[model samples]
Target chain A: MIFDDVTAVWNQFNLTERTIEHLWMFSIALTISVILGIILGIILYQHKKYAEPALNGLNALETFPDMALLVLLIPVAGIGEVPTIIACIIYSLLPVTRNTYTGLVSVRPEILEAGTAIGLTEADIVRNIRIPVSLPMIAGGIRIAIVFTMGIVTLGGIIGAGGLGAPLQTGIVLLLPDVIIVTGLWVGILAVIFDGCAGMIEKRLTVRYGEW
Target chain B: MTSIHPFETIDRIELSHLTKTYGDVTAVSDVSLDVIGGELLVLIGGSGSGKTTTLRMVNRLIEPDSGIVRINGTDIREFDEVRLRRNIGYVIQQIGLFSHMNVGDNIGLIPKIEGWGKEQIDARVHELLEMVDLPPEIFSARYPRELSGGQQQRVGLARALVMNPSLFLMDEPFGALDPILRKQLQEEFLTIKYDIGRTIIFVTHDIDEAFKLGDRICIMHEGELVQIGTPEELIFHPETDQVAHLVDANRKYRHIETFTVHDLMSPLSKREFYEANMPVSEAMAKILSDETGIAVVMEGNNLRGTTSRQNIVRNRKKNLLLGDITTEPITVTPEDALVPVLQKMKTKNASSALVINREGEVTGMLIPDSVLFHII
Candidate 1:
């Protein structure tokens, strides 16, 4: 029976393990993107001369098609999680870096002057005034990166990395409608749940920092 | 009240040949001045006059191109830039209170930077809030946007004074406020300064404010020093035609001269002698009621001279008595021309005139405005 095969397919596949794998790969990519993006943003801010070139380069990285980036990395990094995570990090860098830079640079001049005039050191000004005022924008960038990474991690399964995407690809190869439907549902659900968490984090941070 | 400055004797702030340039345009060109400690020296000029540049130079906000700023006779360049700024309070027209922080945090910022303990900073914030007439319990947690313009400025003043710095640099600090609020804050600032006694360099385009608040005003025009003198000196003896024009706006009231009451008082008429002790307003009311428009001002039994409605009006304060209004009748002998007496009255801010004979006998009377009308 069709129902019997569909049930057998569900029993045969390790859905939980693939979802966990998907989350781990996405988390690794997101964490690296966050750290690298913020550092690059700050570096770009400090040496403004480097900002133009660095930003143009980052824009190029973002403009690279997702699958092409994954394919390009496969030659050196090979298949599986290595190339998949590398692709995810590159795809996520633009929003986090650009937004962090925007947040820091866009702080009001009068506020910065007030900070300096009050005798705060450069470090103190960055920590006390610039960072706090720019946090909401930075958080928005983080949310975007996290959601984008979650969606892109689906491609990891094509490279033989274990994730919710593996079954969806298998179903397409075999032309099985039921397999596609169930696995596609899981992908959409996983993406929404992770994106919601990121959005919640953004909201919490923005509320804590207060509006500028 | 604490000893905020390390220097024992901070007597003067001297700017020597101070100059600044922005690209091709000169913002301040070789301006020099000395301000005594506790003195509020007003720098007055139109836009592009370099008044603000000159003030900012003292705090190194705008570093001068070629000259030096010496605070307490020591070159400010010798002091560490951060430490120097920490010891100098600054307030600008924008009243840049940090929007992120509440009132208490804003006021406590300098102390925090100076490494004051949390308790000490909190206590000081409360104290400054009270000094600025904003109670801590109500204002401490409130952000700057919650405050009105005047209130935000008071917070700015509190923030500046919280450091209790050796000097204050105010660049049109009250320029953002409307006239009435500006006047009120100016008075409040004077009272605050009286307590703090911090040497302040105040910059403004307002000549009247310069006259009111400055112990000495330095006028700037096109990045050059036009003149520097006491308000009275500037008014009476303008060094340049430009200054004369700058001050001409208030020329009508700038005249100052020594004139006795007798010079402007009229002679006794049929009106009963009003004692010097009578309230000026009452005397004015009486003079206005009387058809003769004059009251004989008496010192005990001796009739001094007459006062006109104009004199009473000019000298009248809310509770000022006739005695306070009565000056010795500065009698102009009958030989004297009306023009000279009127000129003296104008200078003296007097309105009435006493026409007396050579022996100083009370004769006919003259009110300056009325007498000038007849004689002209």
Candidate 2:
């Protein structure tokens, strides 16, 4: 009985297409977040004096409500995927950029001293020693971004971006128990799966590059 | 090989009035020194003596507040700090090998940074590893954390040496190791010095290590250069009481080192003499009666073998001849140092050794009890 109900709801909502859209949004937002996070992190690390205020500002943005973030982007980006993806990137910036900055700056002083003593250029030291040593931390930051990206992408349905959240919102409006149960459970499961995969990747990075 | 070669024909380093102050504290004060080309000049002092500060200024790792440092007679400021360090090898106590890189890559880094080919870098890295006694096949792929402290330091040495920079700066590279390992590395360092040492500035707080490894040691105290001299010169002609105390504090045994065997040996005529034909029972009795408890068996003025109470008693029931029980005696010249003479006796498992003159005539006897007293 339950299987029949699930299949019925799945087809009614076109979950196959929504899953694709959901994942598509997630990948784009996460990619942009990581690239920007790393670049922003490097900039902050190079200008250490500005790191405090810049990070505090990012923290303030992080504390801004997620629903409000999506709502605010609507006026700038308008409805649909652009605003949704933009919201995901915005929320993810703090974790990725902060972690990247922390990882870069927290490299062992002796290791940095050794690099300097060996006559490595400033750029070489950053690329070879600092970045490689910070891999585990960077991976940790990316893992957090995955969860943020997944959540923001799902919420995009409220703005007519057409993902699993659309069906969830419909089920909520019409009070269709089957549609709510199936879509809500599916989105939750998908988020868990993505976060779990990222978690595994983070662990592997830690094993490979973590300081003893 | 050219990497080990200095930038110019001679790399004479001159530091004049080099001083560095951190706010109210002076790290190095008006330290002027001339390090000769290819000389392994050691800067030695207690902690905060400004030796490390002095070393860092040579490569501009720490710029002096005032004064000039010249390498190859050219001011160090004239060259890029990065390039200057690239041509000078550096090793430190912590042995900061990149935790992420394997042994081979750690040593190969300088060459790779210099834009050498992959194969050439690998070959050079392996060669440097061999110099430091790390087998390339086993250690090349192992990370720093996988190795022991001593092994990590060896890799650190290899990394510094791989590019063959003509000048080497070592900041207590073996200081973190246990005494046995430190001594072993010091011996190995001397061997490496024999092979490829350039103008090296080695900094250590250990006076003994300085005396052992340095051709000349520069002593620092409280951010000032106190004395600079050879080990012998420092011992015999220390210019300051502070410098004298630094040397004399650990040099009690050094007096024995200076003394020859003649200073401690006894007249051979006073030794217990027993004939080879004597009964084992009689020889054992005589050996037990003597203070040295040793018998120097003689065959009509020609030295036979020597036997002690331990030797005679172990064979007491065997009914053997005195000659059969005795072992060859260790013979040393009267001019030999007491320490080495003691070493010979210890290695040969003999309590007493025969002292002989240039004429091959047995002259004196060496008892280790007297040597033990010197150490105690």
Native contacts, share recovered per candidate:
0.53, 0.71
lDDT of 2 by residue, A63-136 (tens): 99988988888889999999999888888999999999999999999999999999898999998999988888
Enumerate the candidates' DockQ scores in order: 0.32, 0.53
Q: Write the per-residue lDDT of candidate 2 for residues B24-74, one digit (tens) a residue.
A: 999999999999998889999988999999999987889999999998788
| Global fold similarity of model 2 (TM-score) | 0.79
Fold similarity of candidate 2's chain A to the true chain A, as a TM-score: 0.97
User: Candidate 1, residue B270: CA error in Å?
Assistant: 46
Candidate 1 residue-wise lDDT, A27-146, digit = tens: 899999999989888888888888878888988888888878777788899999888888888878888888888888888888888778767779888888888887778889988898
Docking category of candidate 1: acceptable
TM-score of each: 0.75, 0.79
Worst 10 residues of 1 chain B by lDDT: B367-376
